[model samples]
Target: MSRSHIALVGKIAAIACIIFIVFCICFYKTIRTGFIEAQFDRASMYMQGEGNPQDFKKAREYLEQSATAGSDNAQYMLGVMYEKGQGASQDFSKAMNFYKQAANKNHAKAQYALGSMYDHARGVPEDHTEAVRWYEKSANQNNPAAQYALGYAYYNGIGTTKNIDKGLQYLQKSAENGYVKALFYIGSLYFEGKNIPQDTKKAFSYFEKAAYKGNHDAQFYLGVMYENGNGVKRDYTKAIYWYEKSSKTHSSAAFNLAKMYKNGLGVEIDYNHAFELLKRAANGNNIQAQYYLANFYDKGDNVPQDSAKAAFWYDKAAKQGDSRSAYRLGEMYIDGRGVNENFDKAFQLFQQAAQDGNVQAQLKMATIYFKGMNTPIDHNKAIEWYQKAANQNNSEALLALGNIFDQGLDVPKDQAKAVGFYQKAAEGGNVEAQLKIASFYLAGTNLPKNPAKAIEWYQKAVDQGNIQAMLALGQIYEQGIGTTEDYQKAFEIYSKGLSSHNADLQYAVGMLYAKGLGVSKDIEKARNFLKKAAQQGLVVAQREYAKLDLSNQVQDPNMQTVISYLQEAIKNGDAESMFILGNLYLNGNHVTKDTKLAKELFMQSCEKGFENACHILKTTY
Candidate 1:
């Protein structure tokens, strides 16, 4: 009962002292936490005006007190209040200081705020490296925004040495966390093959993921990929679906969808739908859509033909540097199709479009300058514009240049240069140029005569259905110019020209039948062909048609029909028709004798240079 009892009493006393100290520490911490929370609550209430007047001054005071007491949330709030100048003078430096304090305490939001300040030089010296440092801290804690920022910095070498692999790795992490922008960037990198092997399939997959999350850009890309078969089989149906989805926000998507609808791709042709889509895209400021929409209004393709609407759309596209639209609008101004005719405005627009390298506009400029359309004619300017357009291999421009040189219009005649331009135009598929070149070779004009070359160029024009070339070729063959005469070939060429219904060609065929040069001699056939030529007001044919009856020694069975045909020719001012009809009336072969009418017809024909009619009038009267 002596030493053991004293030791047990001392141990009990020590255990009681430890328990009292622990309780005092816990009570003190609880009170401090409650006080900080009360301060923060009051600050929030004052800032938000909870049942009281909003007092930013009082809110800042309470937030400062709470922040000083080591509250990370309070520190971040104080930074915002200082930055915004809520009841205090705005001080970025002060805001940055508070953000730094909270950031150092491992507050993710504060770390991101500090990163943005450094990145954008907001309240701090611009330092991408420092920004990356802070962003990394927050990113490591799974902050999607910070992760994206850090990835972008690495990818662009903004804050660190460029490391595409590392950047993609961080971006993938952010994308996995559902960051829409991160997904889009990653997809773009792969799609463009920037600093990495192009992986369209992978890019498409990532874009699809973002598209499903309502990213308009991603949706547009998905449409492009599907339509072009970039990484998969081309699927117009799917492409249209994606394009329609993105068309609300993406003008390019709307334009593409409109084109698809217009071309009947992956759907039934619906011009009305195409028109609506084009209107949407044009309103969104798409240059191509505006241009095509103008064409639709001009042509009455889907909408009622509206010249005013065409001009409006053309003007919109022209302002955006569309050369074709500018040229078309210029044309409208000149024609007064939609607006009052204003040649000055048309000239100005044409000049603008010509300078922009529109081939048609350059040609128009040449024409206007040469013709002096609503302005003084300047042949030099016309030549300059023609040269410009010719330089672009415009066939019509080359043909125009040839004509200018050949005609010596405002320039010394240069037949060699004219032939050169004609040759160029012919090679470029200008049928008129081909015919001109052929004529040059045939007539030995401005160059050594070459029949083979003539035939070659003529054939080129003939291939394009040039009736003049066909007749020329037939004449060449029939006359045996620098070649053996081939009547059969001449007949074939003349037959091709028959579709033109040209009086000369019809007479030529009649002569061939009469002489049996290119066809069998048949008087009936010759008479029929000559009759057709005579009805078309051919003077030589009408004279020959009248002489044929005297040579045949047999009156035509259809004398009244011949009289009617001659009457029609006379109405067309054919002197030969008047002379023949006058002779018929005097002879009374087809009608009762009327000497007075016959003398009047003879006098009319004599006035038109019919020598036989004058002789008959002088001898009979």
Candidate 2:
């Protein structure tokens, strides 16, 4: 070959080599593109049921391979796969790792996922403060979820000072991005009047947007607003429709729907469906749902009564510090309704309830101490416990304390203090205290005599079933103490009093008859009522019965009855009975005039704290 031809051939060969290298580079780029596209295609096919019947397992494998190759979209998809355990072992840590990787590449969904992981402590220690940092980073990048999360943190004071204004600003920005959750949260803020001038119209607008996006909580809130006419005009049909929509997945919404059905508020009453819905809510650990379900089981309200089931739910709520549950548990233990009778357990449970500020429990503990039932009597402890309850404005406690002071049970008798406590309880609407307050005035013990006030209080008590108040009214009308005497009204009142079980009431009736206060003087009726009162050991009645005329009165068989009645009354610490018995013996009218027995009875009455008996013993016997 010629020398010129050889040089041209070498140059051509070098050019050919450069062309081959360029061709190889283009071929490699095509293969790489195809490989990535193929993985994406496979993932999409599996995800969409186009291949392998929508197998998450196959989709995850394709997504994992592409994600490992540094594809931001694939990394985001892989994070979701791991999060949902799609064709893989559920791994929040792996999901978070993929999310963080994609987030570093400014993948919007991945940024939101990483922020949520930090906020919820899923696959990492929960750090709302750190979550805010990451969320702000993504929010600056126009990530809707990050913006919404940042808004939530600000509104709720989560790792930040609550700033509803700033929260609404960020939330509105996210809403502009079509973030449904942001709209829902902002709507809730407006509806609840949280740190914003409440705007129910704007709230309803936001909620409607989120509800259209199929956000369950937003739907539930929309239903609530419609039901309550808070953000919308009252519309039961709209409330029921939205509630049914939300109840499909939300147990709380289901519970609300059940309540509506139970009360016929927005739907036809359907107890069967209501029961099913409530059970779902109860299973979700809704405390109010559990309480209502337990009550249904306890009462057999359209369901089988089951005390055990009632106790089961009550215990569940009690462990969560529900005061009413604790009280019910105490009752169950005390009564052995759904558990073994255990007074000690009941007492402890009652203490727990009382510490939680349950007035019923406090009063119960006081009554136990005061009555010494199943425990030793502790009057001081009783008073202390009652005072604790009374400070909470418990009328029963105040009345019990008033009575204790008035009767000097364990404290010095103080009518003034008694009246003060009674007034407190009376103002608290205690009918018993009202009657006692009136009695203080009528007897002129604590306050100045005020007949009008006495009658007023007595009338209030009578309206509350106070028998004594009724009898007192009868006497007032009969004697014209506070009003004009009315004999006909007095007879009617005395008749009512006589129908009661109080022997003193019967004696009053007998006095009305004996004095001809209402009816024509009827000796037969008078004697009959006196006999009834005497049988109840009334000392005056016994003396009157003994004074009845009879031929051979000394030898009359009724003398023996009088002596027996007087002896029984003396044994009951009646001072007048002792005096009358002593007089009988001194006159030799009964029992052969036994002076020693009379002296013994007199001394016994005197020692029983009766001053009249002491006087009789000193002067008569």
TM-score of each: 0.72, 0.72
Provide the lDDT at 261 for model 1. 91
lDDT of each: 0.89, 0.82
Q: Which segments of model 2 are wrong by more than 4 Å? A: 1-31, 176-178, 199-205, 231-238, 248-256, 266-277, 302-305, 372-385, 404-418, 482-621
Task: Summarize candidate 1's per-residue lDDT along 1-621 as a digit string, tens digits.
Answer: 679998998899899989988888989888888888999999999999997799999999998899988889899988888888887899989999999999999998889889988999989889999999999999999998899999999988998999888888889999999999899889998999988899999999889999999999999999999999998789999999999999987999999999899899898888888878888999999999999999989999868999999999999999999999999999999899998999889989999999999999999999998898877999999999999999999999999999999999989999899989999999999999999888888889876799999999998888887888888888889999878999888888877777788877788888788788878887777787888888787867876666665455335556665666677778778887788889878988667888899999999999999999999988999
Model 1's alpha-carbon lDDT is 0.89
Q: Model 1 — TM-score against the truth?
A: 0.72
Error of 1 at 214 (Å): 2.6
**Candidate 1: lDDT of 152?**
92
Write one digit per residue (lDDT tens) for candidate 2, span 1-621.
999999999999999999999999999988876777789789989999984688888888888788776678888888888888888988999999899899899887788788888889889999888888788888988988889999889878897788877877889999999999898888887887888888998999999999999999999988888999986898988998998998868877888988998888877899999999898888877787788888898888999999989988887777777777878888888889878899998898888887888888888888888999699988888888888889998889999999899889888988778888899999898988898788777777687878788888887876666678878877888889867898777777667655566666677777677678777776567667877988987777765555442223223356667677767766666776777776666567645878887787668768877787688778874
- Our model 2 lands, by Cα RMSD against the true structure, at 7.7
Give the poorly placed runs of model 1, Cα more than 4 Å off. 1-179, 182-203, 408-412, 491-533, 540-557, 560-621
